[model samples]
Target: MTTQTQTAVIDQLSKHRTVRFFKDEPVSDDVVHTILNAARQSPTSSNRQTYSIMVVRNPETKKKLAVLAGNQKHVETCPVFFAFCADLSRLDVACEMHGEKHVKGLESTLVSTVDAALVGMSVNTAVESLGMGAVMIGGMRNHPKQVAELLGFPNGVYVVFGMCIGWPEWDKVPNVKPRLDESVIIHHEQYNTSSPVPQIEAYNQTMADYYGKERNLHESAWSGPLANQLKSPRRENLRSELESLGFVFK
Candidate 1:
């Protein structure tokens, strides 16, 4: 019962993957404008649009950003890089203009973060539809303070993540990775976790097989590495860093 529009959208989404290697070609300003315009159409919390996208094209800036993002070469090589930021500074100005006291707290932080994520994902989808590829750089959070300083982010603004976009190397394109089974992820009208372990175990086997064939890696299960990763705190200084950026999570 799928319509043409639904099928087309689903096909595009199904083929998505993190494209790291790209060709050394420039993306035109017209394409960039179209992609960003698509991103701007994403929904925002309370219609506040508490987000900003920093398009980085300068070679030196991209080089420094690559270093800040754990020396990811793609950041430096991509024709277009974008820093998606959660921004409350504009909201503060709006409140001032309306003669209302600005509220800065955990709720505001969450809202802005969600807004930025929506825009970022929308941009990703738009780019992919246009036959371009992109990869998100969560490593931007490794040194949030430095990234903020380099980007000249003001108080009440912080980077959610970075994205590198360009034409992907066709030979280096990766397989469409498998995901968790719908039975475990989707619940009908309620939260159901009954017998989730078996579902996870099955998915682990599927992923392990995929990795063995695609990556030539030996792994018992996908969950093992992921579980180990959660044993330690990631970005231990992130809270203090966020506080310094004027996000009081009170």
Candidate 2:
């Protein structure tokens, strides 16, 4: 971690934060194309590249997408929005051209989803490195069917997530969120089975300190909120909806 050894990419990554507020500045098409080209170089499963990016710049379209993404203002406010989709539509076409049928199953679903995620992360890094800010919108899944309809997605494609990129409102940008202790998360040669309760307890305090009095989430920090969230199944309709859209989990 010494300055001499630290790379620019590592430095940028270390300072990463989810930016929710943005300034009224548009991201140029040139910049978007550059970032996307770089991101497209990300490794894919068997070079299938089973993902598509939907770039949205239309104000009205962004407005509808914002509503679909649980009314997140940044989705509408950001200069550019990108929907990273797990797409098998292209694959189906490719197969048809070769006189073969495209098959779908659990593995295909996971591969396409992972491919989208990888490319999205690359795009985020590229954007941040270019002095812009971005936030990934998991809320894209809150109403997947509605989102697909709004965006005109094909049956063999679904958004894995969405991203909002724009110039940051520096005053509103939050501090980098702390992650779990390396000991708790990163295992050794073999999986470390020792209790992580101690590390998690320590992280809860770290998160509490990070949240501070403004947030007032002192006693119940990281784990508490997540526990509450996981108490019941979230996104109950996700499976059926994805299935209806032609994704096969099993």
Candidate 3:
């Protein structure tokens, strides 16, 4: 790709936003597989690469699963949807074949999580590069067991998140949402907070202005909304849900 192409790609990435609704067009199996192929090429922990993606094409299943993910309706309407799992089951099988009960301990759970996240991001980036759009459904964590049952996931595997993918829908196409300034989010050798204060303040104002115009909403600062989200606790039983779905966060 030329410099102009690269610049356009980056600009598209910068403009990318989570699409909540999608058109009725279907994504072909070839395209879905290609997207997953990109995910398979993502970097993983020590190249252990413990992750699996379950593409959900069944409408009934998607509908039921949508309720689990905060009742997000896009799960059903999106052309293609996928559930990325942090899979240790294959390692468990490998260990069993080696006559070991658990060669990879619970500590390795982190690696699988990292692998899954990496692959998910890889698929997202690839999709964006292709001019498609997607939104990651982290709310899948809110119903681990339900999701596992819906997907018929095996033991030693847990869904890290779900993703909705499709061509951009008209009304759902989004404007660029600003991000934090570099100084606020990036840190050098030692984590520096003092220097980020001004940058954060500036970013908050900038994003506030953007939201006010685009959303026709008030110019509220970032911290307030973030704090509000943090203050509203997640489902108290989420840990138990993970445990039931075979992830013992020990």
Candidate 4:
């Protein structure tokens, strides 16, 4: 998909609305295993691999997760679901098995979180490469405690986020969304603030147009949405919940 193999890799990235359906097709377990294997093979900090992935196949679990995600039906309908977790309890057990006490704190927690996110992204890469449809569900953090309870999470483990995986609807393949200029995002050896505001505004305009056509709905651009975040209630109590679950985030 590009001039070279390296650029070809970048060219395959999904942007904007991407895919949401697959004309009655379903992803097979073999393919799912391959994708998960690729993700497991991803590099980890200190090779700890302090993250775990939980696949949800139960209809009831999907239904509950949909409710937790604010009634996002795509979450329920997707053929497969995966909950990526930042797991500290795994390490705790390993340490205890070696006759050592749990010495992990914020640093260990941070590593696990990073490991989970990186592996999640890696799984996405592997799945998308196989022509399977996928979407990330960061909304799992909206009700972290509720999700954890529902999933029967242990004292040292919690869900960082979840994903909806499936085949794309033939008619629902989405176009590439607009992105900010390379100049605005890519800085050299140091940060430069010559002026990204104007570029951001321009990028917002492009995104607005994309949203309008992609969903056939009228939507506001970047600046308006940027201002609206102030009025929103952020449910990212995941850190505090993690602490309650026995994780030491410092």
Candidate 4: count the clashes: 4
Candidate 2 Cα errors over 4 Å, as ranges: 1-4, 213-216
Question: Which 10-residue window in model 2 sums to the lowest lDDT?
Answer: 211-220
* Model 1: ten consecutive residues of lowest lDDT: 1-10
| Two-way lDDT contest, 1 vs 2, winner | 2
Which residue pairs in candidate 2 have backbone atoms (N, alpha carbon, C) closer than 3 angstroms, thus clashing?
none
lDDT of 3 at 144: 83
Q: What is candidate 1's local distance difference test score?
A: 0.91
Model 4, 34-63: lDDT tens digits are 899979988789999888899997889999
| Clash counts for the predictions, in order | 0, 0, 0, 4
lDDT of each: 0.91, 0.92, 0.81, 0.80
lDDT of 1 at 164: 97
Total residue pair clashes for candidate 3: 0
lDDT of 3 by residue, 62-111 (tens): 89878998889888788788999999888778778989886554667788
TM-score for each of the candidates: 0.96, 0.96, 0.90, 0.90
Candidate 1 similarity to native, TM-score: 0.96
The better-scoring model by lDDT among 1 and 3 is 1
